[model samples]
Target: MEDNFSNALLLMGVGLTTVFAVLFLIIGFGNLLIKAVNKYAPEEEKPKLQAADNKAVASIDPAVEQAIDLAVQQLTGGKGRAVKIQRL
Candidate 1:
């Protein structure tokens, strides 16, 4: 009975030590990964300058715009006007 108790105590001590060591390693590795990410993360706001697209859809021409305005008046029960597509 004494031998069994000693063995159980030794096993418990070993298990606790192993758990602590693994926890410490995981925390250390996580800290290192976080530091590495912080060092190289994209913190700069580089503005994406879009090139001006002058291309207009051939189907949605000025004549279609006028038709759209008429359609909007009919669809929304005369509540709103169709959006004007002014060509720049």
Candidate 2:
């Protein structure tokens, strides 16, 4: 019984060590990959927004404008605003 218990404890220690070692290796490799990508590839710049394009909004009916604003608000969950509405 004593020998079996010792063997079990040894196996448990080895298994735990192996698991931690693999976890550390995975984290190290992941960090290395992220650093390599950031060093080699950078993000592109976004296009700048032009001036206000609200000329077409003035000709739209009041009810239509209200409906469009309501739709935009609903779709964006109240986080977005309808800045410019143009007829295509």
Candidate 3:
């Protein structure tokens, strides 16, 4: 009975140690791969959107702006107000 108990404890210890060792190795390898990729494969620059000089920028209405401000204040229980209103 004593021998059986000792064997079971040894097996359990070995299994837990193996599991932790595998997790540690996986994390180490993942970090190494990430560093390699970041060093060799830097991000490319994306093109910025350009608007023509002649294109007219849309203006926001004062009445709509006031309404938005009022709604935001009410939504926040009179604690907040919209700082800027822009027409999409």
Candidate 4:
């Protein structure tokens, strides 16, 4: 009976130690992974003028100016006014 009790105690001690060791390893590795990701993450780049589309506004129709002004006034509760259109 004494030998059985000693054996049970030894096994319980080993199991508890293993559980703590595994938890420590998981926490340590998680911290290392976060640090590595922050070190190598890509930075946000500013938009370049050369990369912008030059013809984005080229398809605007001159006939839609009045309609656009009315829509804008309706949308903005009459606070918006239409500016005079100038032909380039």
For model 1, residues 3-65, the per-residue Cα lDDT tens digits are 999999999999999999999999999999899988987444423322244354343565776
RMSD to native, candidate 2? 9.2
- Per lDDT, the best of the predicted structures is 2
TM-scores of the candidates in the order shown: 0.45, 0.50, 0.49, 0.45
CA deviation > 4 Å runs, candidate 2: 50-88
For candidate 4, the per-residue lDDT at 48 reads 22
Encode model 2's per-residue lDDT on 41-73: one tens digit a residue. 754342222224566656677688677766877
Tens-place lDDT per residue, model 3, 10-86, is 99999999999999999999999999989997654422222233232135455775777779879998767676554
Q: How much is 78 displaced in model 2, in angstroms?
A: 25
Candidate 4 lDDT over 36-70, as tens digits, reads: 88788643342222313335323445457557766
What TM-score quantifies how close candidate 4 is to the native fold? 0.45
lDDT of 2: 0.74
lDDT of each: 0.70, 0.74, 0.70, 0.66
Report the CA-based lDDT of candidate 4 relative to the real structure.
Answer: 0.66
Instruction: Give the 10-residue window scoring lowest on summed lDDT in candidate 4.
Output: 44-53
* TM-score ranking from best candidate downward: 2, 3, 1, 4
Which ranges of candidate 3 are over 4 A from the true structure?
A: 1-3, 52-88
Instruction: Assess candidate 3 and give its lDDT.
Output: 0.70
